[model samples]
Target: MLTRAQVDENDTVLITGASGGAESAAIQLAKARGARVLAVAGESKHESELDAGAQEVPIRGCPLQDQLGDNGVDVVIDLAGGPNWPELLNV
Candidate 1:
């Protein structure tokens, strides 16, 4: 997924469902590639996500745009697809 997204050192990647196994792996990979990672998951999982190399773990329920302000990510890896999926596109 990272390859397809052309993630690179300059990119800021936003990853949803960041507490899951795949998402955790994604976070590490994105970080290893030198891209900054922002994870979105439950508050309970924030520490683990941060440990996995996410620079910031935003609160899951909060609007991604609000947390990120005008500095939107360069790549969005959306692993959680549901009602909020469309919101990711906007961000």
Candidate 2:
């Protein structure tokens, strides 16, 4: 997934469903590659995501676009593709 996204140094990568097993590994990989990792998960899993190497975790109940602001992430790994999938593109 990182290869397909062309993740690189200084890039900002966002991972949805970030508490999953694969997503946890993805966070570490993104960080190891020198990219900043932003995780999207429930509040309960925020700490775990951080422990997995994510630099930031969006607050639950807030829109992703609002939290990300104008300068959004360079890559998005959407592990939880569902009703909110379309919203990811906006961010």
For model 1, the superposed segments whose C-alpha errors exceed 4 Å read none
Model 2, 1-91: lDDT tens digits are: 8888778897999888898898899899999889988999889998998899998999655799988888787888888888887788777
TM-score of each predicted structure versus truth: 0.95, 0.91
Residue ranges of candidate 2 with Cα displaced over 4 Å: none
Assess candidate 1 and give its TM-score to the true structure.
Answer: 0.95
- Largest lDDT belongs to which candidate? 1
Write candidate 1's Cα lDDT for 1-91 as tens digits. 8999899999999999898899999999999999999999999998999999999999999988899899888888889877987878887
User: Model 1, poorest ten-residue lDDT window?
Assistant: 81-90
RMSD of each: 0.8, 1.2
> Residue 33 deviation, candidate 1, in Å?
0.8
